[model samples]
Target: MKFKVMAFLVAMAAAVPAFAQQAGPTTDLAKLEGGVFTVDKGHAKILFSYSHFGYSTSYGLFTDFDAKLTFDPKAPTSSTLEATINLDGIETMVAKLNEHLKTPDFFDTAKFPSASFKSTKITVISPTTGTVTGDLTLHGVTKPVTLDVTFNGGGTNMAKKYDLGFNATGHVKRSDFGLGAYVPMVGDDIALTISAEFNRVQ
Candidate 1:
């Protein structure tokens, strides 16, 4: 038993260095690859929340989404992005609520089907932070919105692909998009948060 324990400990010690050598994304812009990248859907998510009658906050998210990013290392402000979210993919973790959200009272997935955003401007505030102004189309209405974005990191992943990660937050008036169902009772202002990872495709 002593010999077996010793062998296991030795093997575990040897693996530590290997694990340490494996690199993930980093917060270094100089190392980021400049090109077109596609969202790594498996590593990305879009979440939204709103006040519920001032009692609590209700949260939900869209699971099926895709985005394409155009990055320029030399001129970061020139970067742009386009994304689409399937309205039918909304999830609140409650089966009935999820189905209700798809009804006309809320998103009305049958009519809109999807929401999309196309960035019109990218402003670099610093090495790792910026703002993105874009046209957001949701619930059959289009409006301009700006999102505060942070460049979380960039690096080459284990798959040998250049990966970049970002976090963005924004707010929109639900009524502006014709999504006002409960109004003040459910809240008209909606907050959106997005965390995504993009893998270089070009």
Candidate 2:
């Protein structure tokens, strides 16, 4: 019995090297192809955080969202992005807090059930980073916002199709969208962090 267990462990250890060589994304931006891409819902997320009275930070996320991308790897400035997030899907990890956030004092999910963003311009800063300026509509108000975006990687995904990934960070003032109920107490500025994966539209 002892010999059998030892042999099994040895075999598994030997397989690790081969398993690590499996095909995956490449960081080479020059190798990417330009086309339309749709979000891989399972591999994307939108996270928001805010300062809580200078003591701690509160975090939440919108689990139901989708995005479409018109990409141009050669001429990255021509790329465009558009996304819609379901405000009702916001999750704060606390059941009671979740309910409260949907109230009129906060998101008022009952009145505004969704938010949308449409890119107006993209300025490439490097092969792996850029700035995306767009109109963000939330809680019945629209404002111009810019996000600093980084190209994570791009290549053929496990599904045998080309895929692209990105990480972005930005911020907005709650007052701009009429969601500033707590103001200096809860927080007026909201920080947004996004991680997303997009696959070529086949």
Q: Which candidate should be chosen as best, given TM-score against the real structure?
A: 1
Q: Once superposed on the true structure, which residue ranges of model 1 sit more than 4 Å away at CA?
A: none
lDDT of 1 by residue, 1-202 (tens): 9999999999999989977775876666677678999999999989999999999999999999999999988788898999999989999999999999999888888888999999999998988899999999998899999999998888877777888999999999989988888888998998999999999999
lDDT of 2 by residue, 1-202 (tens): 9999999999999988876755677666578787999999999999999999999999999999989999987788988999999988999999999999899988898899999999999998887888999999999999999999998878876557789999999999999999888788989999999999999995
What RMSD value applies to candidate 1? 1.6
Q: What TM-score fits each model?
A: 0.93, 0.90
Task: State residue 29's C-alpha deviation in candidate 1, in Å.
Answer: 3.3
Candidate 1 has a TM-score of: 0.93
